[model samples]
Target: MTFENAVLKLVSGQINRVSQPATLRTEEKAVAGEAASQTPFSEEALFEYHLYTLENPATLKNNQAKQISLMSADSVPIEKKLIYDSSRNEINSIFHQFQSV
Candidate 1:
């Protein structure tokens, strides 16, 4: 193509980029505005998130060490008990190090 045609094509691309209208619908724009205006998580939502973390095996096992039933049921789903035991020991040691500090 001619140099003039190449220049025109570049100019057209720039205009297209600059003049493109926003694509969000009115409802979507409102939702986007609301999300921008509010905190991502309220205190209640944060607390619930924390409660969820507490329900996981890592937390439950740490908190219920004295309970025989919990100890028995605390086994991971892995078929290899040796690997599980080694990893559990390592995790417990790391946990203890953190607790000590």
Candidate 2:
């Protein structure tokens, strides 16, 4: 199988002819503290999700791992967020946010 310039979030697999969820590897980088510096008074902020696309067709093999390069941009905008989830033991989580353009 091969994919070219595809934004695939979920992929399917077959196990004993039964359809199942397939695993995919992804790499992402975001710059934090950029948005926080702009809006310090906001309690919650929205950020963009980075979309990665292949420059060429990537071939996939069964039970074999392959590394491919996605799109690379210089100085991509990002936001840093601190989330407090009450449902998950009241522990705070820090994550970089990205919005898809």
Candidate 3:
């Protein structure tokens, strides 16, 4: 509560805030380097199927694709998003039962 203590706290917070970005960047680089060091091939290089699998030009279903579509925008590649055709359509009614919970 004293002015000296308050000023020291503020300075400490500011120093931490300034260094936080560098700390985060360093941590990210460290993890990436560690992961890279273990493997002769990265995901892009090792897994040709993951990198080069062809997707259908046409979107088959609207409702089921929503979550997959949104999450697909992120850098992480999802394997489950690649789906085959199915004619079933009870999801809206099935999903409605869980609304109260």
Candidate 1 global CA lDDT score? 0.30
lDDT string for model 2 (1-101, tens) is: 54444433322233364665554223331222443334323232224333233334445655557754322444556789878887886749888765533
Top TM-score prediction, candidate number:
2
Ranking by TM-score: 2, 1, 3
In candidate 3 the C-alpha lDDT for residue 26 amounts to 58
| TM agreement with the true structure for every prediction | 0.20, 0.25, 0.18
Alpha-carbon local distance difference test for all models: 0.30, 0.44, 0.30
Give the C-alpha lDDT of model 3: 0.30
Error of 2 at 10 (Å): 15
lDDT of 1 by residue, 1-101 (tens): 11221111001122345576769766556554554444222222332232111122222333344221211212223232222356455532221111100
Separately for all candidates shown, the number of backbone clashes (residues 3 or more apart, or on different chains) is: 0, 7, 0
Candidate 3 lDDT, tens digit per residue, 32-76?
555444433323333323232212233334343321121111232
